[model samples]
Target chain A: MSVSVRKTYKLYVGGKFPRSESGRVFQPAGNEAVNVARGSRKDLRDAIGAARKGLATWSGSAAYLRGQILYRIAEMLASRRDGMVQELRLGGLTPAAAQKELDNAIALTIWYAGLCDKALSLLGSQNAVQGPFFNFSTIEPTGVIGVIAPDKPALVGTLALLLPLLVGGNSVVALVSSHAPFAGLALGEVLAASDVPAGAVNLLSGHRDELAKEFAKHRDIDGLLVSGPPDAELTEAAADNVKRVRFCNLSSAAWSKVERLRSLSWVEPFVETKTLWHPVAP
Target chain B: MSGSLSPTEFRVPPVDAVALEARTADLATRSIKKDAKVQGLKLAIAMMDLTTLEGMDSPGKVRQLCQKAVAPLPARTDIPSCAAVCVYPDLVKIAAQAVAGSGVRVASVATGFPSGRTDRRTKLREVELAVRAGASEIDMVIDRGAFLSGRYGAVYDEVCAVKEACGDAHLKVILETGELKTYDNVRRASRIAILGGADFIKTSTGKVSPASTRPVALLMLETVRDHYLETGKMVGVKAAGGIRSAKDALRYLVLVAETCGDAWLSPEWFRFGASSLLNDVLMQLEKQRTGRYQRGTDFSTD
Candidate 1:
């Protein structure tokens, strides 16, 4: 009998793969035991620190350049499509369904990449005034964002929620679904090779119940994107820092609606608007 | 005072790295919550030496730091002010003026600070200038080059000279343990600093990695305990750098209480050399009171 080699899926932090500080691991479906890093509150704290440090550089990049990087992510995903599809199939998805989901993930990434530069024009405004002054309003990224992925359709749902936030030039610390964590780990590998800056997108595979309160209360995170029903305790904790929270009801809406998923509203929640005025002489 | 004795006369036993790390890990698991947590948070706040030692530091920045040291959170009167404001020597006068009536002492980092590479005369002169500019405390760095080269006597003598230059001001000797590899070096450096007349022995300059780690702080606290047992003198310990959160600060508090007893818990015997740690502690205190976390923008940056 021949022995097959297996891979250990570690958490992506600061653009590097590291085991959990707690030194614990869990088995996701279709994978061997001790593969995924079972992250703790300390791991969450370290991820937040990495996101904060990457914010200045990621948010300061040109919109066009950011769009190019997002396109690069789609290309990387496409090249690794076969491996991802196989992993998804082993995690309980049918062959045809797995292929469709992979296609949707790539399409959604490209769609968001194209909208990076155009979001400002659609969401911003030029105010009309009676005085000799020119005024305008513009949107800016809201620093580091925290995300919680839903369990079902783990791959597409996570990409749909994450791409919009990244397109808006904000860094993310995402906690992948505990049920199907292998798909998220595969995506992390693709992101590492996609020219995405280190610390721009960190992925953690662990129990959501253990980390939700930390995601809400961490002082460094500026906004949160949670998929599924609104959690009362988590929402209340987020109020302590007055951080912005958006809940995506994946069960209520169709996941294949590209127009709805790619709308400007999805991007608006993670951005802040600033209005500027200047006096013009006659 | 003991000219006949050599620097190598005092000896420190070898440290068990694994055992020391395990002990620190166990102490970190102690849960401090509710009333006890609030008290710990307040005590930690009172032990802070709010520091800013950047090259870009100006008179205005030092004044802002002083203001922050005096009234950490003005809206909440229950919060106690910090122990002192730390800055470079040139800005000592400005910092002193900013906290003139606030009862917050001014501390200055001398002896070429992060790197003690200069001559003894220059180092002593720097100490004198800071004291003349109204610095109530001087934080001096030990010459790691001399100590690493097996010249323990030179390192001890330099610390003594800086202590004399401080006059009546309290002296804090920074070991810069990150540069000094091995636990034995840290143990020996702690002994040298205490016997050479350090009012308080510090762990780092906050400019290097592995600054003020739990094991390092634990070892230094033990040194203070042993020194007290032999000479009947109580020396303080300051854990600077990389201690950012309230939970970490609480762990240091636990180490001090468990090792050296509660006598060293007060600000006079313990201090935290940090700048951003104050805001995190305030946020936790507010969370305890309001049952919610606070926005960073609600607090002042300085």
Candidate 2:
């Protein structure tokens, strides 16, 4: 006799798979076969803590090392492409659509990987100042970020928002769309194997509206990406902490161009521009 | 100044390490959530002994710590102040002045602190100095070397001397459980300290790895309980060092209630000797109140 083992769709926080601390799981729609972790605010807090620790090592890492890690994520995704496609299909995606989503996600990863090393020179510049000083502008990752991942085309949608931030060295605590979390959670497995530092990317499967306000109100989430329909509540909460909130259109349809997703617009919002002033050496 | 009875004369039962560990492990699984969780976190906050015992400690740091102990979350008046602010003997005066009007007491560690390597005379003098300097509670370390060498009488006498020198202040004897290395030794030292008149029995100095563990704390609690049953006197238990989370603190509260009954549940009878545990408890309380998780930047740091 053979015993079959089932996969558990748990939250990926701090590079580890843990069921919700609340011990609650929910069935999405009519799918009895899928029970996703109904992440609570406590779970979100833990993800932020892990992301903060990951930020230390990730942001401190050499830009070249970060590039290598992003490339590794792309490599792992390519190897697991078929499995991911099948996983996405479980979310009601057609065979061809699932394949395209995985391919675009992989391609997007590669695009951002190349952008990592060239980020400084390409995004920063030297400026002329009136005084005897060289004024220069540079870029840095904006610490830990919370992303409201787009609901449709889950994998590619999350990566579109995630890759640019990671390329800039910001660790993420993302809340994947509750409707289709299987593929997004599966991506966590790919990132884990890809050598993205433990907490560099965290994913939670739960109601976005419930967690989005929490993401904005959280004092440590230095930046947030609200991906879908505009929420006035999240906007009000982010104002309390002066948290930098960026809204992006990540509907699956928008991701078809792929080129638009690869631009500086995504990377610009997640980076801080620091201006430096130095007297010219005598 | 040796104990009244010979060390071998006391018929203290040998601790069953596995059973002790299993009991404490069972306590760890109990779920204390929502309203009860809020109560426990507040209790954990009140039972905390905010400690800063570094060689580089300054008057400013001690005063700042005292301020936090007084008003952990300045915005919330409902939160109770910590039980005490623990520091070295030299800084007790500063802590006492800082927490003067506040109900928070000043506790100073004497008897050479983490390592009880000093002579008995110097140790007693240190305790006296701390008591004279206005520390309401004195945390003294036992001569672990004497306890380990089978010189139980010497260890017993040192505790007695320190307790005497402490005068009106309560004396909490530190076993430095990490160095004790065994459940049996922890129990024996606890018994020795209790027999010699300790107001409280603490686990570690917060300087050693494995400073406090569940099994060790359970063993100490059992010793205290058994003594209270034998005699009517009750002694407090402080699980110090390495306990950093609100969850871990709640499990400890459960252990105390299970082993020693609800009477030991108060900060007067039990304490957590930790430096970083206060903020985590505050954050948990805030999470309970606001339904949103907290970040470190929102709270003041030590």
Q: What TM-score, to 2 decimals, does candidate 2 have? A: 0.93
TM-score, each model? 0.83, 0.93
**lDDT of all the models against the reference?**
0.88, 0.89
lDDT of 2 at B138: 95
Q: Candidate 2, residue B298: CA error in Å?
A: 1.3
lDDT tens digits, residue span B16-79, model 2: 8888888888889999989888888899999999999999999999999999999998999999
- Model 1 sits at a Cα RMSD from the real structure of 4.2
Q: Candidate 1 on B47-115: residue-level lDDT in tens?
A: 999999999999999998898899999999999999999999999999999999898999999999989
- The stretch of ten residues in a row with the least summed lDDT in candidate 1 chain A is A251-260
- Highest TM-score scorer: 2
Clashing pairs in 1: A240-B293
lDDT of 2 by residue, A1-282 (tens): 999767778999999999999999977764678789989988998899999999998999999999998999999999988889977888888999888888888889999999999888888999988989999999999999999888877788888889999888899999986788889999899989988899989999988767788899887789999887667888888876678888886555676768878987788888999999999999
- Separately for all candidates shown, the number of backbone clashes (residues 3 or more apart, or on different chains) is 1, 0
In candidate 1, stretches whose alpha carbon ends up further than 4 angstroms from where it belongs are A1-50, A90-92, A120-137, A146-152, A173-185, A202-221, A224-253, A275-282, B1-34, B112-114, B117-122, B144-146, B149-151, B208-210
